[model samples]
Target: MNKYATCPISTNRINERVARLNGLFTFLLIMLFIITRLWYIPAFLAFDFLMRSINLSKFSPLAYLSKGIVKLLQLKKKFINAGPKIFAARIGLLVSSAIFIFSLIGFNITAIVLASVLALFSFLETAFGFCVACEMYPYLNRFLNRLQ
Candidate 1:
């Protein structure tokens, strides 16, 4: 058993890491087409993995990582209250990665332009701790409440 596994991730620190990684992976998923057709499997598997990883930092991140396969097999809908919103920027990352890869292969005429834009955004996020994806959760939740 690794260290990060057994620990219960109820703390704010764990939550923060989960949010950040979720954001990063979501970014990876957006570019699935070029990354590989099978990327969805990894993407969804990653979803399950993150859902389980909610407790990772408490115990062992490695142990939580190993369970992705099991979680995928069980397949449940433990939806995140604003998970998708918290991870919105990740979608942007994936989209940008796809375009970046595409641009490398000379597909879209504006691949360079698109890549540059996304890269710039990513840089800002990394450098200044500006997370566009996570910032919308409160507003999104409010909007959802209004819908109710």
Candidate 2:
């Protein structure tokens, strides 16, 4: 069997530098939520993720910020397949939504733990260009296929 049989693929491309910058912004926002215990932060992140997931990245605040930063820095664009990133955004939307709900329900510890994991994933993406969500996609896809 092919190892990456169920991995996402797309002809669409996106700037890797901007995507990494967005990851940095996401990490910072998650940390801000952890520090302030502000439910709105996660809510905002969830909304931003939703925008990105839906291919409406121009509407995402993080994407706007990251694009501006990339332009200001004169970073050369490195194009990458958009499919994995889109998958990652969907996962981000789910995690951020869960975090927001957990915070609203007074599950502080659970929210914190989940946020920490998200922060770690974002940090990895920002610092190392490693996408945990992309790595997990094949396995998740295989599992879901088996369930169907």
Candidate 3:
């Protein structure tokens, strides 16, 4: 048994503002991909993956931008469980990577569909505080466990 599984880190470690900002950033980038089908979005996606891997997403460029938006708008912090949001970020990373690969390989329709899905998820998180990836995490874990 993994000791960490029994004694996981506290979930309330990140601010809600960060998650919202992340969603907002994701939404914008995905929309850009939908419109341009270019490299910028994919490059940012790669960067996001790298930062998350290093546990430095809090210091990411969009994070700073989001913080600025919060300050500029005088938004209040609404802290919540960090675990789900982190999971959602991982999902975002995966989708973005796929979008990048598909777009690069000339699979425009597939990339567009994936980007649309990602944008929808981001919009939900940004506007409604709902995270599809977060909601799916538990079920996915259980399913994987059963399959093993």
Candidate 4:
């Protein structure tokens, strides 16, 4: 039998590098949404949402950029439970999808509002290490379980 077969080097967690990179991606998308010249940006973000929601971040271009940033900054990988982040990503996906649909329908004001909220979320993650969606997951879970 192999020694330490049960010892796993990692688990269901992502490091700060990945989290920060994701925040940067969201921040940029928020800017694009606000700029108004880049109409296709939201469509691209919709695709990114699909990629992330499906757990394909490894294939995402922004992931590559974030990896580069992590290397450049020599940031340490401090892994934390991935469940919360995944929940947060789903929330982000919903918001981005809504923004995409609203923008496509020319409901610019609604799109802007949603995008701004997303921007706030991303900014909090990037600047303050706060994740609203992640924070809400436990409460939401309990609430749902109560419903059932």
Candidate 5:
């Protein structure tokens, strides 16, 4: 993490605000996605923007999309520097987002229940700083790397 990265949040360790926001966003986004609601899309979209305003989501999908849209367009200098908290948010959202899309075929009750549980976890990060996905990422990466 750069010393001068936005978010006024100093620390590779995820900050309290980032955790709470990520948790709330994940829980709500997943809940919204399950109901086949269009409202979730804008809500989700707004999340990255909010994070960006606070300097949380740095080089996320939108940033990637912008750069992809115009190769010559220079991304903001701070755009590419992803902090740990934002990274956790990115990964959690990625997983929950997939679950949301998968629920479209039908209301998979099991999936809904599982997702709700995950949402609660995001909520818990506010108090416990528990990032289940981040904790798993390393082992999963090692296992996948070994397989390859």
Candidate 6:
């Protein structure tokens, strides 16, 4: 469990405070989607997650917003391995994409449930620094390795 705290899959490091802020933004966006039932909210999140997942952080609006907020708050940097956060972004992309597709096809219930779960995950990340996706990564990595 402790090993996951410093994920070694990527050598890059990122500011943990900024990552938490990004999670907060994600949580708020999902809550907004839940309240407004606007399909584009999830769609935008999916696109943003896609950008981050692909290492194009410069293109992610959430990243930019998070960075700005951190700067405004004068938060001290706390660096951590980027691997877990990158993996979490990929999971976010998949979940948001599913929410978008489900909402588009009239499966409102499914979309809402998924959105709720995603919101909870994001909340945990923001409030508790607990990343469910990061915990799942080692098992997933081992599974993928075995398939090779």
For every candidate, C-alpha RMSD to the true structure in Å: 12.5, 0.8, 3.9, 7.1, 10.6, 2.1
Task: Pick the lDDT winner.
Answer: 2
What lDDT is obtained when candidate 3 is compared to the true structure? 0.77
Q: How close is candidate 5 to the true structure, as a TM-score?
A: 0.52
| Deviating ranges (above 4 Å) for candidate 4 | 1-10
Give me the runs in candidate 1 sitting further than 4 Å from their true place.
Answer: 1-11, 14-33, 57-127
Model 6 — which ten-residue stretch has the worst lDDT?
Answer: 1-10
Query: Highest TM-score among the candidates is held by which one?
Result: 2
Measured by TM-score, how close is model 6 to the native structure? Answer: 0.92
lDDT-sorted candidate list, best first: 2, 6, 3, 4, 5, 1
- Give stretches of model 5 more than 4 Å off: 1-14, 28-83
RMSD of 3: 3.9
Per-residue C-alpha lDDT of model 5 across residues 24-98, encoded as one tens digit per residue: 655566667557544445345445545543554454445344434344553322222235455455555554555
Stronger candidate by lDDT (4 vs 6): 6
lDDT of 3 by residue, 1-24 (tens): 332242223435677886788788
Q: Estimate, for each residue in 1-148, the C-alpha lDDT of model 4 and write its tens digit.
A: 3322322223476777678777878888788778873567766766665676567878666666787888898888888766666677778878888888888888888989988998999999988888888767666666676999
* Candidate 1 per-residue lDDT over residues 1-148, each given as its tens digit: 2322322222232233333444344334434432443434333534443433343322433224423533555643333333433254344535455664555566654554554454444444445545554554456556676999
Better of 2 and 6 by TM-score: 2
Candidate 2 local lDDT, 1-148, one digit each (tens): 6756777888889999999999999999999999999999999999999999999999999999999999999999999999999999999999999999999999999999999999999999999999999999988898898999
TM-score of each: 0.34, 0.97, 0.86, 0.84, 0.52, 0.92
Q: Note the Cα lDDT for every prediction shown.
A: 0.42, 0.96, 0.77, 0.75, 0.51, 0.93
Shift in Å, residue 100, candidate 3: 0.3
Judge candidate 4 at residue 98 and give its lDDT.
86
**Deviating ranges (above 4 Å) for candidate 2:** none
**Reference-based lDDT, residue 29, model 2:** 95
